[model samples]
Target: MIEFRNVYAGYGGGDVLQGLDLKVEDGSITCIVGPNGAGKSTVLRVLSGLIHPRVGEVRLGGAAIHDKSPAAVLAAGIAQVPQHNALFGNLTVHDNMLLGGYILRRNRRAVRRRVDELAEIFPTVAERAHEKALNLSGGQRRIVEFARALMTGPSVLVLDEPTLGLDPKTCQAVFETTKKINSLGTTILMVEQNVRFGLKLASHGVVMERGRALLAEPADDLLRRPDMGAMFFGHGIEDPTAAPQIATASTDSSGA
Candidate 1:
């Protein structure tokens, strides 16, 4: 499990995440949903070691990992797909994935073997190995990022607003892709702005406001509860319109 025990982290002066105490279970998808500037991405950054907590502990399976280097975080089996695409638009897809293996023995033989194995799991990476990353669509680019993150063989995958900027069809596609990844056994922790989409894709749900956690529960329960709706979507708090239309999203993978 990955946890934040009283985590307090921020930018130059002010703390965005204040006293965050949370946990993500192994092999489960946990979604953190909140409004703008609620420090959703900040939580992922701290977990991945891009930002260290100003105070308190960040632990993985009970060992303190706060303030470790990004390389150290990767070695500890954590990989992050940032809010942005985070791919090298200038490089070929194959090279971008190879970079994820930076902490590994980068001898050509080892890199090639790992790449081939990942390509089997994520066919797009293999099919477009020679193509520049810029040529892919938003959903396809997100898949490439997932493929790249897998090169590290991380135990935990952290993604930030992964479906942002996509059309409804694309959003559904991305959610399905996340399910397929979880089935492969990596634990997932993410911040998603698509409130309904986020909760539906996850087994566990975390709600935050003003940089503090407000609620954590089984995702389907969160969907059925009135307060959970109020917290995520504000007072109007409308449930998914025509949910029958969007119900095709697979929540079967969500085993709380």
Candidate 2:
């Protein structure tokens, strides 16, 4: 399980995450939804050790890891795929995957074995093993990214907007791949802009506004709640067409 207790963090200007208190149950797919600037990506950054909390606790499976280094966080069985594609476009797919396990280079045999296993799970990895990452389509690239993140066989996977620029069909495929990964026993925590699809895919849904989690519940329940829609889409407010405005926070128009 991953838990955050009264956590606070931010870049130089100000705190983006403000007193966040949340828990992700073990072996579950938890999806976080919020408008841009709500600190959704920041939450993942904190988890991956890209950003450290200024205050409070972050625990993974009961171990304290708030301010640990990125390597330390990965060693604790957490892997993250950032919002942008981290692939080496000029490198072959196989090489890109190998880079993900660079720390395990000393055990070359183990890395190869793991790569083979992942290839079995993600056929695209095998199909494009010899091809440069730049040659693959958007959906295929996302699949390769997913495969790379799993090279370490992490217990927790943090994905930030995995399907950000894909078509509808490809987006669904990516979601299916996410479910496949979760089914294989890795816990997943994701931040997504596609609200309806994300909520439907997740076991648990979290709604954040201005750096705080305002609502957390079963995905189905949250989807059924009228107020949840109102909160996220700026519905029933002064201007319905305006971008979402968190009622508790000052109004702003930003894309999720």
Candidate 3:
């Protein structure tokens, strides 16, 4: 489990995540959704040790991990897929996967074995193992990142915008891959722009606004409450019966 207590962090001038308190339960998928620039990505950065929290504390399981280095955080069993496809376009898919194992250089044979195992689960990576990463589609690239993240054998996975620019079909593909990763016992902490799709699969749902948690509700109950759209999206959608468009949007987003 991951816990944040009055956690505050930002870059340069100000705090984007202001006194944020969050909990990611063990063996569950927690999805954070909110408007653009609501400090969604900042949470991932703080936890991944990419950005240091100015105040408060962050803990992985029971240990205080605030202000740790990125490598140190990964060594503590955390892997993060940043918002954009942070891949080297010129490198072959296999090489990209190898880069994730720098922390495991001593276990070369084990890394090779794990890469093979992951390729079996994600055929796209296997089929294009020798191809340049730039050639794959956005969705396929996302899965490769997932495979690469697992090379370190981390128990916690932090994902920032797993699906952003893909078509509907491709989004479905990425979603399925996320499910497979979580099934392997890697706890998932994700920030998504597309609310309904991600939340539907989430065991826990968090709503953030202006760098603060507006609400935390079970995914199912949140979806059924029409006020969710109005509160989060700034639309006056109070009742499902009165608004078919809102109903369809909410229902479709819930992955139903």
Worst 10 residues of 3 by lDDT: 247-256
Candidate 3's displacement at residue 127, Å, is 1.2
Given candidate 3, what's the lDDT at residue 108? 74
Per-model C-alpha RMSD? 6.4, 5.5, 5.9
> Which is the leading candidate under TM-score?
2
Model 3: residues with Cα > 4 Å off, grouped in runs: 234-256
Look at candidate 1 and give me any clashing residue pairs. Answer: none
Judging by TM-score, tell me the better candidate of 1 and 3: 3
Off by over 4 Å in 1: 233-256
What C-alpha lDDT values do all the predictions have? 0.81, 0.84, 0.81
Q: Any runs in candidate 2 off by more than 4 Å, and if so which?
A: 234-256
Quote each prediction's TM-score.
0.87, 0.90, 0.88
Give me the displacement of residue 6 in model 3, in angstroms: 0.7
Write the residue-wise lDDT of candidate 1 on 152-214 in tens digits: 788999888898888898888788889999999999999998888999999988777777766
Per-residue alpha-carbon lDDT of model 2 for 133-210, expressed as tens digits? Answer: 999999999999999999988999999898888899999898899999999999999999888889999998888888
